[model samples]
Target chain A: MSKNGFTRRQFVKAGLLTSAGAAVGAGVLKPTGLWAAPAKIKGPVKVGYQAIMSGTLAGYGEFHKMGATMAMEEINKAGGIAGVPLEVEFRDSTLKKPQAIKNARYFVDSWGADFLAGVDSSGQALALAPVMAQLGKPLMVTHAATEKLTEIEVFKKGIKEIFRICTPTYQDGNAAAFVAQGLPAKKWATISPKYEYGYTCWKMFKGTLGKLKPGTEFVAESWAPFGTTDFRPHINTIMDAKPDGLYSVEWAGELITMIKQAKQAGLFKQIKHIMLPVGAAMDVLEGLGSEMPDGVWISGRYFFMFPNDQRNIDWVARFRKRWNHYPAYVSETGYSAMFAYKQAVEAAGSKEAKAVIGALEGMKMGSPAGERVFRKEDHQAMYEVPWGLTASNPKYPFKVMGKQVVIPPVEFFNRPPFEGPGTHPPFKG
Target chain B: MSTKATYAIYLGIIAGLAALGLLGDRFMVYMGMRVMLLAIFALGYNLLLGRTGLLSFGHGALYACGSYSMALVNLHLTQDPLLGILAGVAMAALFSLIVGFFCVRNTEIYFAMLTLAFGMMIFSLIWNLREITGGDDGLVGISRGSVFGLPIVKDGQFYFLVLFFFGLTLWLVHRIRSSAFGLVLAGIRENHQRTSFAGIPVKRYRLAAFVVSGMFAGLAGSLGAMLQYNTDPFSAHWSHSAEPVLVSLIGGLQTFSGPLAGSVVFVVLREIIERYTQNWMLWFGIILLAIIMGLRGGVMGGLEKRLRQRAATRKGGE
Candidate 1:
């Protein structure tokens, strides 16, 4: 050792030899010895986003990508996770199962992504769940609302990697049931896209209504395949039933198409109240425009006007500033999911998967949607589900929620002893 | 060269693919299995398009029929994978027979369009009948069970099973292409009226080819269903039907192994392009346009043609 830590000859001799050989004698080696730690590997985190990126439901995928990109940019700005920059590896599921499965494998293998995210369709999500389990990688689902995802088949079958940001279909249905109870409607007509999510929504809504209002009856039900451009037959059938109110689970372009057809067919004027469970999206509302009608009850995962908290306001402002449009509940759900992941990671203090999973389960975190907690029992998020009457607003380009009600987590959630298996209603009608 | 050389080449390719699959990780094995399955399906489609000159756009319906048959069999019947696949093939053949009887009457675009409409009808029917078909949720929880007597759980094992079937299908198609019946079909393709005048029942041959194609497609579909452990209405979509057509065209429709070569290229290209860009379709469209214009006879066809030209020139010089 010399004045500059080593003499000129000593430094030259050390430099002449490989680092590993010097370490053998001196017991001194840098932690990441000679590797240079790979200068911030350029390339997005390769998030294998699978959604209906084409066809009718393309907007949902676009919104999801927007929300994901916004969160990714923020995360990168704060010096990315352990200095590995994030990137998105998107695959258009085209709302098909085979394509979804194919994309899942491609994302995991070809794209070299350890983590996976993004699925809009419940069908697609259910298809991907087992594959994710098989691969032993975490898939952060944002938009799919299937109740069965966190149930026995997936969560109990050694698939602890799946985490959902959206409320389960049952929760959305229960919220609709809660809204239905406040209205003067007793008889109900329901129409949902004929699939798992649709069937589950109907089942939960019926079950919740029966428990809350014993006298309430389901007068009629109509199920249509998704992307059914001609809702005329279904609409006619619903109108002919003449129930006191209608419960609808249709959303995105399908919902917009139904509304336009129904409005033109004079179906909205006849029904006392329209309980559109997913009608709160700005896309749907904007498409419907003034024809959305007043006093129709609507519930969603997020309402831009509901929370009024600093987090919610700031999120909206930032989202508006970036996209030049109001963030829908879908976008907010994605934003909340990213924040939830960040919180879980920070809480765990390590990116170790098991630690982060433990942190996530039953963990409470503040989102722009308000205080939400993931139930340890089933991994379902419990939070303030916003419901309101849809009214035309001049201040905004589309229909906005008015006369809002925020159903507290406790009021809506069936707290543990949460049924460890099977399904349970989240709210009383 | 000789029949032995042809068989050797086919076996060599299969063995090489198996070795490659075993060396790779689970993801590669999975992709390899997918490519082989698509190759098998495209080969089935090729039987009609390549040999019979009958373009059936509703091959996806037959594929879905096979998949749904397997799903139903897997759920209701014994989980014996062999029996399930056989059941799928049988059901698909039966469906093709019914659909082909009416469809074979038309030719060209009319036949294609009719098949498309029928395929979409089946798609909608299955999608709408949620109680049985599981609706859009699809039939999940399908166990892939043993192949023959061996437990086929690993991706590598499944890959060999796919390769085995793919080789068998290729052999069968090769035999069919060289048969006297193949000659008659070729004659029909060149001139249906002339073939009809020659006392051959053109409609019957076309329908037979369609059914055979459907059976093979069903087999591929069953393998896919087993691999994915689920099936959906998308398998029956018009897009799925068009995949084989695209593969056939891209590989050179005239060659026996064109679809197989095309399937590998198509799947690999898609995987590579999708990794870099989300707008894979835009890139795929551009590449496909280039392939179509630059190499009219497709990859193998162009290569074979060039080799023949080079050999002829060398012989003349000698």
Candidate 2:
């Protein structure tokens, strides 16, 4: 026994005393109200942005952050939203769902964020959705493309706080089907990661293809685990099927790995056409470089070259200047989402969650991608989704999308057979 | 008399904490639930590491197995929350039985590596099995069920439910620690050969401890799954498995309450540090290093030892 030593009893007593002191201190201390102090209005309306700040998906997170920062800067320079400046409180999700939820809670509960925004992974977005619903906070999901999010099973069944700005997986699947239908491809084989996003993409593409061209034989379907580095076996299986075309839904590192492996194995040359649902990212394209097999069609959430609008051009230029690279669909989607949030806030004329949600529903907001609106019936964003043919470009460092077409949102998004009961207060016309 | 008083005091503190958690805002309530859950997990880990001297690097698999079971049961089977939890526990127990059969064979590092291998295998299995487990997208849109037939809709109600489970787990662990089975485990930990010579089945005792630990961990995991409203493959990852080990080590592996204290401190610190800076790992590493080097017996263990010493010195002076 030492002089500084205290027994468990003493320590417990001390802990209780400390807790009592804390309680008293809390009572005596001047309470800070939930809302930010009006007099402390700074340079901007600080929007705490938390996303995957680092990891394998670091590049995408950085791009999304850059996009949000650019949007904030642009909005502030353009007299700001509702005459108040906009700033961003950037937190890192580290590409983990738990961390994403924690950061979301912190942003809303502690930082007093005006709006919650940005998500890269569908799982992360889904995890944060319930919290957003509970908090009655508007979250503009920018990157995650899982259609189940806005479906009746999820959002309509009381989780109505999520507003997906990115094109849903179903939309991308339809775009692929639309492209595939026009091509001289009869049999289709699919290799997608086994997840909601990948599975949904596969199902929707197959279903859409079936609807478009009857008697299209589905030769083979290989479901690789997400983040599986080895695609050799799967590629071999796909090649063995010898389908006229291939549909690949693998994205990020897995996609990069598959593309390189497929190119080496000469699988790309054998298939008449390859439709990668998520290979349109600038990072992935750049990573693939010349190895990104030519003539393959791909659909993405955004393509810097697809939109010929001045807004799109300006956004690309600004983003390029800041990030030192072409903006991916994710970055563009994030940028568009923030702008959309501002539009909704302005339209609602209040920061109230329900009011803003009402303002967002069916309200068209202009972005570089064009006027995108959230279908009031379901919260799915309705807009032009970009699909393009892949081609090697010496002018740029990476592969670029060539001969692109923007699929109208209405053409693909199935309106009826909503997944869940609508909990969002009925649209007041 | 001292033990009884200590028990009473701990109960009082726990009750007070629960009340505070109920009264606190949503953020506090959420954090409180997290702490309770983590504490329950750490307590389970402590049974093996602290009392039984068995270090498991694969408990996360059991935890995740329980969570996924809960998710599966909740999604596909009956949404009866209690039934879902029971299903989770049952699955975890079954998983532990299989893994523990192979794991309890070796000693020290071999045991650890075997557990790690098993845990990693489970992680890979969960990550790859998309149809059943949802793979990377995870099992989403899970309904948070009721507790003991009571609606756990509100944060306060959920907090109490978590506290109830947490308290139940704590009491169970305490009872086990003080029981004759616990003494046998301690004997096996202290000297396996001597225990065997004394006609005790060292292997059986060790396996029993592992099974009990797994069951409690499963309960915690199931609760966590319900709390998060989803279960991802990460729950089964080696990193998650390592968390309990870290919690136990940091809290000091000497006492029953060490892991509980460690979990509380670790989670709270993580939350506070994350709020201030994004580079939390650097700070965390530094703090953990300081604690390990400075405290020796871990934060709580060192504190308790010191307190006992001071009380002894005062008694001697008197």
* Predicted structure with the largest lDDT when compared to the true one: 2
TM-score of each: 0.89, 0.88
Clashing pairs in 1: A44-A86, A44-A87, A45-A86, A45-A87, A46-A87
Tell me chain A's TM-score in each of the predictions: 0.84, 0.84
lDDT of each: 0.80, 0.81
Give candidate 1's TM-score.
0.89
Q: Tens digit of lDDT per residue, candidate 1, span B172-219?
A: 888888999888888888999999999999999999889999999899
Tens-place lDDT digits, model 2, residues B1-318: 288887997799688877777578778888888888888888988888888888899999999988999989999988877888899999999999899999898889999999999999999899878889888778877787676689887677878878888889888888998899988888888999999999988888888889999998899889888888888788888899888888888899888888888888888988888877777878887998888789988988899889999999999999
The top-ranked prediction according to TM-score is 1
- Residues A66-155 of candidate 2: C-alpha lDDT, one tens digit per residue: 788888878888988766777688888876787888788778877788788888778888788877877778888888777767775344
